[model samples]
Target: MAFFAALHARMTGRKVGQDRFGNTYYESRKMMPVYNRYRRFVVTANGQDPTKVPAEWHCWLHHLTDAPLPEDKRLPWQKEHVPNLTGTRYAYRPKGHLAMGGQRQASGSDYEAWTP
Candidate 1:
């Protein structure tokens, strides 16, 4: 399925810059009659998860910017994008999180009960 998508993209779409994750971006060479605008899309290097796309590329994919990253350029202060870790082993676990196998510490003197 991805193979055909890639082929179609290559045949009718212009290549945009690829992100660090290897996801390739593209824009239709010609406008579609249905939308009356060039269609934009991304081929994920691995999974179909959209979070894999970086913020800079996200803008281009959504047509937020007329210029793609290849032409627009990223700022130096920008950090590399990381996919969301939810549902994975690397997901954040607070001190008392059940997955962390730790119980919540008892409230101490600093704790105050709410009064009506």
Candidate 2:
């Protein structure tokens, strides 16, 4: 993968600007051969979930950043990237989750519909 990346970059004469969360970005004074051609590919442990990537990486991927984020300059408002794993076991378990206990608390009252 790295070899192909290097080849493409070299052939295109793109300058590698930054890398974060295993993704790399490149730019060239010349336009890319393909439209919407992103210079970076995010590498993930399990793959999928763009959310798994950090905020900095997301910015680069979306062309929001002209330059990569610096380690010391991360903004206070930026939250750490967390993947949404809904329906999966790794998803966050709330205190009152049904999986933890067989108990089902009453919301107000159980209503039964009447039919003719």
Candidate 3:
């Protein structure tokens, strides 16, 4: 319930900035008091992938922008940040695959024949 209340506040907050992945950031001159201790006017996102953050909002979050988002800071060679992949299947697999190349022995049942 508290989380939902805080989310409501964030949705109605003074729209500060939005990220590339539709994540939005909000700020208040005076922190809006919350009934729940964990809920407050704090920065948050759906998840932590830096790439999810829009360029402008990311800049602001990282102290690069003073007025929401700046255009001059955009530059080439800036690799987009990707989320940490630790346990996902898409994660890197060294050299050994599940099917390592050990041939299975034929079943004894294969030699059995039907007598006409």
> Which candidate gets the maximum lDDT versus the true structure?
1
**Stretches of model 3 off by over 4 angstroms after superposition:** 1-6, 31-51, 54-59, 62-65, 71-73, 93-116
* Winner on TM-score (1 vs 2): 1
lDDT of 2 by residue, 1-116 (tens): 65665667556655554444554445644655686454544444344456676666667667787665664576789775667878889987766688877566667677879999
Q: Report lDDT (CA) for all predictions.
A: 0.83, 0.61, 0.53
| Candidate 2 global TM-score | 0.52
TM-score of each: 0.73, 0.52, 0.44
Error of 1 at 19 (Å): 2.6
RMSD of each: 4.5, 4.6, 11.7
Global fold similarity of model 3 (TM-score)? 0.44
What would the per-residue lDDT of candidate 1 be over residues 1-116, giving only the tens digit for each residue?
77887888899898976876789989889998997889999988886789888887888878898876662466798776789999999999998999878888887666788999
True-structure lDDT of candidate 1 = 0.83
Question: Alpha-carbon error at 100 in model 1, in Å?
Answer: 1.0
TM-score leader: 1
What value of lDDT does candidate 3 attain over all alpha carbons? 0.53
Question: Least lDDT summed over 10 consecutive residues: which range in candidate 3?
Answer: 35-44
Flag regions of model 2 displaced more than 4 Å: 1-21, 25-40, 45-49, 75-79, 108-111
